[model samples]
Target chain A: AQSVTQLDSHVSVSEGTPVLLRCNYSSSYSPSLFWYVQHPNKGLQLLLKYTSAATLVKGINGFEAEFKKSETSFHLTKPSAHMSDAAEYFCVATKGRDDKIIFGKGTRLHILP
Target chain B: SQTIHQWPATLVQPVGSPLSLECTVEGTSNPNLYWYRQAAGRGLQLLFYSVGIGQISSEVPQNLSASRPQDRQFILSSKKLLLSDSGFYLCAWSASRDSPLHFGNGTRLTVT
Candidate 1:
């Protein structure tokens, strides 16, 4: 079974501070990993994806994630936080394209100005 | 470029009323379609998926059902609405295997 676990249900950070949302996955095969962000009343936007490429992947809006197979983790990070970055973040894992993608419980980020 | 549309944006239905949520995709063909539901303050739960017309796969057993009558049209239905069914329903599509799924704006269904 493919599954993802988000460590934090909620995270708060001051503006211009670094942000980290942790995630771990369990999959039998080399799976594809992804991070998605959902803003208020908006659809989920893909922040980044890992498809067996470089271990470190950079995504839109200065967001990045590292896929560490040894630890079975794919944690999302940002060097600086902004108010607009406050939203629900989801970690996802899939066995393959044909398989169903599993979603984590999600972490709600709060940015303090 | 591909787009997924799901409507009506919000719905309030009585417990015994029948429910219908429709979704359509454009600028793509033979895409994989999916229906996901999110409860209050919860993550997404995959309800159903379709790889082709008249082909639907249910990920979890529930009161809801899904159909793909056309290549890009997917519909979710229930004979009778339940309070437990009230949630945000999202429709999504993927071009091919291993591709990231694109989501619709979503429909908020409130069963009262």
Candidate 2:
């Protein structure tokens, strides 16, 4: 079975500080990984996706994630945090089986102003 | 420039009432549609997906049923609502299997 684990349920960071949210995935096949952000009652928006092209994937809002194949980890990072960056982040993986995707429990990011 | 739309942004219904949530896609053709329910602070649980009109696949066994009456319209229906059914319902669409999904603003359903 394919699944994603988010290391932190909640992460607090000060404005202008670096932010890191850790995620680990387990898959039997070549996986397609993605990061999504949901703001309050709004729907989820795709951040970035890793389709085995590049190890370092860049996304919107000065956010990026590194795919560590050796460690089976895809951790999201940002050089600086803004108040607008506060949202719920989810790590997702798709194994191309039954056209289904696995979603993480999500990490709530809080930016302290 | 495709967009997905889900109606009834917020709904409050009494128990045992029939529930219907409508979703439609525009600017896309023959897209795959999906319906998902999110519990409080939990990940999304996929309820149903449709590849095309009249083709619906269920991911989880539940009291709800889905129908794709048109190429770009998908509807989720429950004959009798339960309190457990109260959650945020999201509608999403993808161009294909390899494409990322685009979600609409979800409908917050509260079955009181």
Candidate 3:
């Protein structure tokens, strides 16, 4: 079984400030993790993914995440938040070569100008 | 280059009415397809997934059903809609089990 846990349900960041969204996962085998963002009334977009490659993965729109095997955590972060970054973010995980992708409860990011 | 398409961007129907949401993938063959429902303030919930034609695996028991009539076409259906089914329905496709999923612009389902 594979599952993900988003530590925060909501996060607020001011424009030009740093942002962080914490996530953790549990899996019986090596895990494939991902970060997706959903804008209002829009589809989910893949921000980045970790497939047992580099622990620190860079994604689109100046976002990045680090996968810590020891801690079982993959946390998303950005140096400066933008207005367009305000959206619902999801942490997803799946065990090696499994079609079952488990999703976290999601964290709503609010960007303040 | 691959793309996923979902129809009926928004739909509002009364309870007990039937529901159908169509999803298709282009430029990819034998891709893994999935249907996910997201509710307000809640996360995404996987409803079904298919690896090939006529092979669908349901994750949860609900009033809805899924079908993969063709290699690239997946459909979500329900004989009777329920208010509890109101949410955002997303269609996604992946090249393989460990590949990243590409999602379509979801369909907004509102069952009143």
Candidate with the greatest DockQ versus the true structure: 3
Model 3 residue runs over 4 Å out of place are none
| lDDT, candidate 3, at B82 | 92
Each candidate's fnat, in order?
Answer: 0.60, 0.51, 0.80
Q: List the residue pairs that clash in candidate 1.
A: A97-B98
DockQ each: 0.67, 0.63, 0.76
| C-alpha RMSD over true interface residues, model 3 | 1.4
TM-score of chain A of each: 0.96, 0.96, 0.95
- Runs in model 2 lying further than 4 Å from the true structure: none
Q: Rate the local accuracy (lDDT) of all candidates.
A: 0.92, 0.92, 0.93
Tens-digit per-residue lDDT, B1-112, candidate 3: 8889999999999999999999999998999999999888788888999999999999999999999999999999999999999999999999887788899999999888
The lowest-lDDT stretch of 10 consecutive residues in candidate 3 chain B is B94-103
Tens-digit lDDT string for candidate 1 (B30-97): 99999999988999999999999999999999999999999999999999888999999999998765
C-alpha TM-scores of all predictions: 0.97, 0.97, 0.97
List the lowest-lDDT window of 10 residues for candidate 1 chain B: B92-101
